[model samples]
Target: MFINNTWYVAAWDREVGADGLFSRTIIGVPVLMYRDSEGRLVALEDRCCHRGAPLSVGRREGDCVRCMYHGLKFDPSGACVEAPAQGRIPPQARVRTFPVMERHRWIWIWMGDPERADPGLIPDTQWLDHPDWRSQDGYIHYDVNYLLIADNLLDFSHLPFVHPSTLGGSEDYASISPKVDRLPDGVRITRWTLNTEAPAFAKKVREWAGPVDRWNIYNFTLPGILLMDSGMAPAGAGAQDGKRDGAIEFRGCQALTPETATSTHYFFAHPHNFSIDQPEVTASIHQSVVAAFDEDRDIITAQQRSLSLAPDFKMVPLSIDAALSQFRWVVARRVEQEQQQAAASATGARPAQTAA
Candidate 1:
């Protein structure tokens, strides 16, 4: 049920270090990642080709991994270099390697054909690495499917009831209307509230004392990435007119990676342009976001449990679900394309792309 022929966030750059090997399951594949002797990262199938052993349990020798169950050794290229007690290595003694790239402080991996993996397809998250911006990175594991969280990001109408204390105000929960657009690759949702009261979290982060103009610009990119640019400015400030000189802007980079059919790994980074040098402000923002996501985790898990018991239950569409429906359509189309390509490849045939 996972999309293979696409790039997905494998891990945050700070997560896998040079000292130890990191093991993760992606799209039902057990993968191992680690830094070689040169401090560069490598991704490969975690299973040993010979004994079905997990290479992650082995020792790291230079840039190669030695299987602990047996004495099989695999190089960074996934080639079996040494096999103890065997005089010669078989031709099939190798593990599969994945195309990996480290950009914007995130390790991205391609689970399909390496030739089709385009680095340009990865969304631009350069702000998280800018010198003048302050960023906080956090992670959460969800028991629900990643699509469920994607639906959550596309629908803000639930904020009033779900995040009443943080992001949702009395009127913003279900009243604020969003303008939705289908991007070439994903969906975009934009909503601007003029001269409105800021919520508790927004007030704490932006230090807005009274009413202010706020904007929520959320872009859901391909596979599963949501880059949200939101902020608040003084009341009567022409924020809609591009006048944000005194405004506090916060950009959040959220990447969702599926661990299994029913589990997901959420990596989120909150970057603010206002507090470039304040450690306390960064810490506060991080805590607030973690709390907010924790709130989401509770609700998503409960929904997942209920859905598991009732798989055929359909979500009744509503006015507020317009954007979410479009988001789901976009994702389903991409997944279908990938599945078709895989089937074609299995039959030794080439698949043609449809014109937009």
Candidate 2:
């Protein structure tokens, strides 16, 4: 399981309304999120202390969340500010509040110890600031473990068989070799080439002119975020050189937060450079990609069910799975390191021995 100690994309900042409540599950934990009257975002454990009802089901009252069950009000800090029934605050009455921040139009939540929540820990995205890139937001729910989806994203080999209609045409099932590189600050980059004719989507872009060569950069930051650079260059040009020409590039970032062991909340943003600044052109590109993603949703969800039923099932992987293996190992190592740090903290908190 992915550790809860890392940062996960919660929601788009614009999606959270000042007077509305939103409920979402992150890493299998139900959480209630909202913005205060000042437009500051806040997150708290969803359960109401009064009767265990979800706080999100309640209404907002003067910057506090008022429970519908008994009119109990909780402040942004999770304090029971008003309990009409009791008329006084109980010593033990409080909901767990989490650290949240808004960045690049997205709301991010820190699920681990609040003391360790550092906004700087979130991966830096300088490219988004570039004037040339145009950004689009998308969301989807997947009935599968977040890991399965992560693995799928890291492996391009499945494109031919699983996503032939969408982004799979370049998949040459026979000769795919993936390479992985570890970078500083818990960053990993996976690279691979899919050798096949361009898919319909790529062909559409090709109609503008030039042959097609696809080069992919699969970047995995700590926790559950994935940044993908899917670029198509003129055919016959080397992979590196293809990027220099007027190629159609799709840069997508995905945040997969586990709703349960078998369900996940998938949030994605695609910011591109080609014809994206224009609303009409951007809408056309967004629609095309969304159609492809809908196709993948069916394939990934079924794959998850199949894997769950047969725990021992293992298939021979092609060379393309090398990067995936690297990714899995990196995640495992990070989780292990976090566990060790937590254990060490616990040991240091023990009471000291009295003088003998």
Q: Considering every candidate listed, which one attains the maximal lDDT?
A: 1
Q: Can you give the lDDT of residue 293 in candidate 2?
A: 75
**Local accuracy of candidate 1 as per-residue lDDT tens digits, 1-356:** 76777889999898889878999998879999999888888998999998798988998898999999989999999999999889999979999999999998989999988988999888788878988778887889888899889888888877778878876766743778889988977888998887777877766766666788888898987788999989888878788888997898888899999999899999998888877788888887778788888989999999999999997998888888887788777778877777878888899888768555
* Model 2 per-residue lDDT tens digits across residues 1-356: 66777788888776788768999888877899887777888899999987898988898887888889888888888999888857678967889989998777668899888988988888655444457887667888888888778877776667777667766674463255656766532345544453347666666544635445667776776676777787766666566654446667777777778788888888876777877546766666666667777777888888887888999998777665666666666777767767776776788753433221
Query: For each candidate, what is the lDDT?
Result: 0.86, 0.74
Question: How many clashes in each candidate?
Answer: 0, 2
The best candidate by TM-score is 1
TM-scores, all models, native as reference: 0.96, 0.88
